[model samples]
Target: MSRVVSRGLSAASGMLGGALAGAIFKQVWKLASGKEEAPQATSEEYGWREVLVAAAVQGAIFGMVKAAIDRSAAQSIHRATGK
Candidate 1:
């Protein structure tokens, strides 16, 4: 039962983490690149460098946020269940 509950919590937190990461990425991108929005790959105005850099930064932010959220959820479950 606890395992099921933990899995559910983890899934929910993963979604929340994604949303949080997106907002953070936007702000970081704006500050770093002076652009309100990151360039899309299909945008002819942006070259490969801009698109690739944005992708890398976004991926790093998302990965870190997901890891932090998952770790926190696991620790909470462990503390509650002693498992």
Candidate 2:
């Protein structure tokens, strides 16, 4: 039962983390690049360096946010159910 609860919580948190990560990445990119949007891979204006840098930054933020959210959820589940 606790496992099922944790799975559900994890799923929900994953979605939230993705959204939070996207927002954070957008703000960071704006500050770093002075641009409102990150370059798409197909965008001709941005070279490989810009695109790769954006990708790396976005991935790092998403990974960190997911880890933090997952850890928080796990802690909450343990506190609630002693699991």
Candidate 3:
């Protein structure tokens, strides 16, 4: 595969991974908190602990998803090009 094609696939995979992560986080948050909406970090209604926890969880999920997608994309490119 060409470099352009590989880059395109990587970009597409990253976007899809981000979307998947967001959906997963939303569902997990709902299940864990029993609330449909997650607490905002800047909102006064939520305590600092709750806000920090939500931020941490979301950040972790996003990082993991991005890493996984990036690694998968690189492997796919390597396999296709043998380089």
**Pick by lDDT: which candidate is best?**
1
Q: What TM-score does candidate 1 get on C-alpha atoms? A: 0.92
- TM-scores of the candidates are 0.92, 0.90, 0.88
Name the better of 2 and 3 by TM-score.
2
TM-score-sorted candidate list, best first:
1, 2, 3
Q: What would you estimate as the lDDT of candidate 3?
A: 0.87
Give per-residue CA lDDT, model 1, range 4-68, as digits (tens): 97688878898899999999999999999999999998999999999999999999999999989
The reply for model 1, stretches above 4 Å from the true place, is: none
Worst 10 residues of 3 by lDDT: 1-10
Worst 10 residues of 2 by lDDT: 2-11
**How many steric overlaps are in each model, in order?**
0, 0, 0
Model 2 residue runs over 4 Å out of place are: 1-3
Tell how far residue 43 is off in model 2, in angstroms.
Answer: 1.1
| Pairs of residues clashing in candidate 1 | none
Per-model lDDT: 0.93, 0.91, 0.87
Candidate 2 lDDT tens digits, 1-83 = 86697688778888889999999999999999999999999999999999999999999999999889878877887798798
